[model samples]
Target: FWESLLMQLLLFRESLLIHLLLFRESLLIKLLLFWESLLMQLLLFRESLLIHLLLFRESLLIQILLFRENLLMQLLFFRESLLTQLLLFRESLLTQLLLFRESLLIQLLLFRESLLIQLLLFWESLLIQLLLFRE
Candidate 1:
């Protein structure tokens, strides 16, 4: 009976060591898998950040193109309006010049008619005086 009890105690000690070793191996594996998952999450976050930066660059390019187009359109409109104003001013100047020319011509014609009437009256008076002296 003493030898049997000693053998049973030895077997129980061997089983407990085996159970402890298995539990330690399982815990190590759990820690390794957790670290691997954390590393994968960090890589995924970096990739997402890179994608967002690329998208932001593309949007910046689009905004620059739109601004350039708008600036070009504004320049074109300004040029057209400037040309229109110039043409209108030229037309007004020409009309004013023509009106001034017409007014000067009318004054010259009226002055010429008055000078002719004065010359005719002077000739008639001279003829009447000469006829009275002959009588």
Candidate 2:
């Protein structure tokens, strides 16, 4: 009976050692899988950041092009407005010159009519005097 008890105790100790070794190996495997998952997450995050930066750069370029186009349109409008103003000014000047010419012509005609009336009066008086002296 004493020998049988000793053998039983030795077998239990060996089985306990085997169980501990298997538990340690399982824990190590769990840690390795966690590390791999963390590395994959980091790589995915870096890739997303790079994609976002490229999209932002493209959007900025488009905005700059639109701003330049708007500026060019404004300049074209300004040039057209300036040309219109110049044309209006030229027309006004021409109209003023034509009015002045008409007024000057009217003044000269009035003066010529007065001179002709005086000449006609002088001729009539000379004829009457000559007729009386002959009678």
lDDT of each: 0.92, 0.88
What is the Å distance of residue 11 in model 1 from its true position?
5.7
Q: Across residues 28-134, which tens digit of lDDT does each residue of candidate 1 receive?
A: 99999999999999999999999999999999999999999999999999999999999999999999999989998888888888888888788888888889878
Q: After superposition, how far is residue 1 of candidate 2 from its true place, in Å?
A: 10
Residue-wise C-alpha lDDT for candidate 2, range 13-98, written one tens digit per residue:
77787788888888888888999899899989999999999999999999999999999999999999999999999999999999
Using all chains and alpha carbons, the TM-scores for the candidates as numbered come to 0.64, 0.55
- Tell me the RMSD of model 2 versus the true structure: 5.0
Model 2 residue 22 CA deviation in Å: 4.9
lDDT of candidate 2 at residue 86, scale 0 to 100: 92
Instruction: Point out the worst 10-residue segment of candidate 2 by lDDT.
Output: 111-120
Q: After superposition, how far is residue 134 of candidate 1 from its true place, in Å?
A: 8.7
Candidate 2, overall lDDT?
0.88
Best by TM-score: 1
